[model samples]
Target: MVRTPQPGTHSSTDHDPDTPQYEAGAGGWGSLRGVARIFAEARSSPEALRILAGQNKPKGMMCTSCAWAKPAKPHTFEFCENGAKATLWELDQRRADAEFWQSHTLSELRRLHDHDLEKAGRLTDPLRYDPESDRYLPVSWDEAYDEIGRELRALDPTEAVFYSCGHAGLEAAFLFALFARAMGHQNLPQSSNMCHETTSVNLLKYLGSPVGTCTLEDFDHCDAIFFFGQNTGSSSPRFLHVLKDVVDRGGRIVTFNPLRERGLVEFVDPQNLSQMATGRSTPISEEYYQVRPGGDVAVMAGLMKCVLAAEDAGPGTVLDHDFIATETTGYAEAEAAVRAMDWADIEHHSGLTREMIEQAGRIYLSSNRVIGIYGMGLTQHVNGWLNLGMLCNLLLMRGNVGKLGAGVSPVRGHSNVQGQRTVGVGEKSAHMPADKLRELFGIEPPTDDGLNAVHACEALLEGRMKALVTLGGNLVRALPDRTRMEAAWPRLRLTVNIATKPNRSHLVPGQVAYLLPCLGRTDRDVQETGAQAVSMEDSLSNIYGSIGPAKPPGDNVRSEVAIVAGIAKATLPRNPNLRWDDWTADYGRIRDLIAEMFPDDFADFNARMFQPGGFYRGNSARDRVWKTESGRAEFTTPTTLTALGETPDGQDVMTLITLRSNDQFNTTIYGFSDRLRGLEGDRDILLINRDEMSRLGLDEGQPVSLVCAIDDGHERRVDDLKVTPYDIPAGCVGGYYPELNPLVPLGYHERNSQTPAYRGTPVRVVP
Candidate 1:
């Protein structure tokens, strides 16, 4: 069923349009290699100049996340193709603002195509699109803040929801959570819900902690790395540096993914001295296997079965029987279930050979320290929690749970989500109660549970919720069932979004919609008191200060904390006796309150954050003691093995999985198309399997339509879209999210985690 790219798909002169044209560069192994080489060269370049460089910087401002963000002398070519595209994403280009809004009403703006609307570029002013006037009007910050404060003050604290994006920093998030708690609210919906909700839930159950158990420094000491459903070379190019070190040191790296990506095959390390000089690419994966999209749990169970069998056969130095019996529960049950499964069924369902699975198991048995790294690919499945649970099972069996360089790591999307959860931004759970809240903050917090991302959408649609105030993120577009979300916007009493530029969420007109342009991560935030440095919590739960080198975009744009404080001042008047003005003057005062409230983690937040490297929120999982009732890791039993949904009953329909392109982040579309995929200047093309297309009576360049059977049961067909049939598995298709999010059903989500099961959706094709 493997459909590799066709041969002879590239021409020698791809850039020269005057050369004889051929379908040669359409799709093939050669085309894939060419794209990979282009990206590698860009990554290795020393002079990593952004393609969209302009008059903004003093000549040294590069992407902070890119490899070129360091202080070393820049290489000749350092920025990747995607990094250049990301630079274009943040260029000082202007999208039509008050003037364009004046010409078109909110209703008319809603009629424009997604690509066409994005082409309008960045927004410059605070705007309020008026439905009656059929135009967007410029609104003052004072008026907008006043309207938002009044609406928030009117609602019961539980009714208001605060959602965050991946790009937000710890300082802004801390201030946002404080605002909610000050107002006696706890409804916090964030991007973590959609990405790694399962990892947090499952890891907490088994390891007594939610964050990653290992740090980047631990990669140096590891003997084996189980890369479960993560594409390191693409998602985080910096990971290639770590993997290259592992291979150079004779460590084995195993990968379990449906697609054998080129980045994993061989990566030319741009940072390595000898590799960069010689243009030598180091192979990452010693053994790679294609595990079926949702079959990770089953494959992991099989591996655990092999481990237990080996332990029973003979006493070995690798297996720690004493630790297993003392620290973990239900090992015998897990072993029985795994041993009961037939090898044939496991292979058939997992789409992996037994030989390949055995190789992964052998690596685990021989390695002194094993680290499991996973990304959204593992957590976005139907049984994502179970997948994470199995990884914990593997680590627990080998006594690798508590030790350094041996633990589960779920790479996150956002910079500060882990910190936001620490600063009192979550729903009511068993561990976090109202009594604890009263003891910490000196005030009784709300006892009721709040709405999550999914529940917020449902509440908005049912008219149970009246107001929506976003700290940072695109709610309408980021959520599944985009059509219903767009329609639900008008039902709100007020909608306030604090963002950097124009996004699709702004187009969703509320009765009173307000957009407050704010300072970006790279911009300096100056207040009446002085210049301030914001903090960000990294993937390892470490809080560090972030001070931008560049000046603010405009004088009118406010800092996120300032806007939050303004709303708080307007909504909850500072009592002369209680006094809140001092807290707003210095952010350290806020941190002091946070440290007192969460003493277990942030014990000297002010002193620690001032330090150069910042501080780490010490996690007890380093000892491998479960905080659960059992006091040890417990294996969960599933009520149902199969996901409850409409199965493909020989209708020739394929499951569609939408993803973010290399150029784009979450909701921000950096460019029109993905260049690495050989997709030219268009974003609407559907990448299909060549064999599957032929079977469906469709041609390569034919036009087709897609109807969303899941969301609102409406026709979501897009016509005249060119179909580029290429290498894809049968009964499977892929496309970009948000643009194709309307196809996902609202109720289709992971069981325990409430994360959308975006990878597996049954859809029929029309031509």
Candidate 2:
């Protein structure tokens, strides 16, 4: 029987000693101090310094923080503040070894905060949950593997789900896919499923390819850049350099977000000695529009409507008719849809007047080359795919895509999220064709559609999924409806987590849970073929090599490739055709297989990896060669302008946007402070507009509870949340993820992509 997670039972109530202080800009002395504080907390070692020096460099490991593109000629100090925190966090000397596990029982560990769990340091050994003792006891690698294999083999292939994290390298991802296929199931749910699955689903329909068409060089030539829902500073701070370059070169940047993100407002590059010395910063967005949460579709449609209106005023002069006629389909339908939308409906939904929308459209019309960049904000909504489709429609109106300095760029999070998808770590086996699998590895993959994150969770709760093998990531914490997930987590028969550090997910153990310690990106991975370097594909499909130089924290810690291979060898029947041993011996063999599987993208895999900035797996859409069924880019007409459905009668609700702190990376909480947002030492706080706070009869620093508006019978609420007034749109509130994830119902997700609507979760505040 599952017990309901009581509200405020595990919430963070203690506030920081200092009051919340909003900084003027992002990535200045504050960023430096934040980084310094983390380093100090980690008790900076020589190994840490070495790892920091090599981060994002050509010869060093890629920053495991975010999937921001790296330059060909990298800067001396290539990493950003968050990147540094991610690196040092991995290189922390403190070890959660046998003693640590013995001292802390599962119940005791569950009581600790997410940040405290992370600070417990690296896992030094393979651990199996001892139910009798209510603790995790260290076990031998072979013993753990044998037990896992026995459990997995006993369960139906369809009952097991393999979850892959984006932080893994291409080699590991490729092997993971091969393992899953070999095991006769395609139940591969990945980190991408939660964040940018909408980008993939929508882009594939519109542009044939599921990746961004633009490269890093596009920022240089782009005359205008439009940012929708992406906070460049906190999510991907390194991108600030690219935006700054555009701003410095007389480019126009238009931003549309609920909050006035400091990064979008202004950025101070820490690398720029002169600017740092003078406390000077480069202004980023020329125009910032604080659109209401879940109103992106309306805002986007209004922009297209304005563009269409302009085209009507002077046909051919405004729109690229020749390109549309030649390179695209369904333009007529898209145009008609935009023209039919009423301005009042658009304004009421978007919380922006006609003049504001037209002004932004005018900027778009004036610019010869434009780049549309967005993040999870645009993708994690009920109408996420529609939001992206509308953005694509706007770009197509002016023929911005398939040209230099122009295209839709989805700023993907995680280091190798794109790479994992590229290598076929997905629920579908379309990338890993059935015939190809049969021919290459003599494996018969499942024909039926596999489970995504949402489905996997449902399966777990319903006792359909027996086992879950995660490569990395805090799966439980990253998901929506934290209370339900927490309750449903133990329903699984077996849970295997291949991880480096401790997190809250590890606490929610299954009936038989095993924690397999794996090598971090910063740790040296020495195989039979000597020190190995893994490759990662960035947000723009740029593949680069990452070689870790630091020694592994423990002798027991193994490479992800090795751990995955071990599981494969243990679970699946012995096949002469599949060389799991050889692949683990030399990851280059895995890359070789990937090259064979994806010849176009990863041809000459090992050789090209050594190149200075790596290689770009060119997008067909970028070259004006569409791979869609119609053999041309297609324009998608949004079905409706109502993004987050109609609010219930007599219910005063605010759309909630889950955010990552400046000191955090994904679910890894480095510290409580979100320096850029002027937040400190608190994670259970909500950022509401001053006017909205007053309307709700709420005061700053007042404790409040959030009740999810979704009528799922079960109450979804998180209590003891502090309300802090912020510069966000009214009828919208912002809170850190994992904490507020409880308020986002699991059933409340995007219709098309099924990505959780983490950004625009409708909820009501109560005393």
Q: Please write out the lDDT profile of model 2 over residues 1-767, one tens digit for every residue.
A: 00111111111112222335454578889888988899988877977877788788787889998999988988888899888999999988899998899888889988888888889989999999999898899999999989999999998899999999899999999989888888878899999988999988879989999999999988899999999988888899889988998999999999988777789888888888998898888888888887777778888898998787887798779999889999999989988888899988787778777777888888998999999999998999888878888899999888999999999899999989989989989888795878878889887777888899999988877889999999999999899888988898888899999999998989989999999999999999998989899999999889999999888989999999999989888988989988878988998888888998998998999989967777988999999999888999999887887567545544376778899888788888888888777877788888876666777788889999988877869899889999887766666788988788888878889888889999988788887
lDDT at position 193, candidate 2: 86
Q: Which regions of candidate 2 are displaced past 4 Å?
A: 1-21
lDDT of each: 0.63, 0.86
Off by over 4 Å in 1: 1-88, 91-124, 273-278, 315-318, 429-442, 573-580, 610-614, 637-648, 707-722
- Candidate 1's residue-wise lDDT over 682-709, tens digit each? 6666766666787788887777776554
TM-score of 2: 0.96
- Global Cα lDDT for candidate 2: 0.86
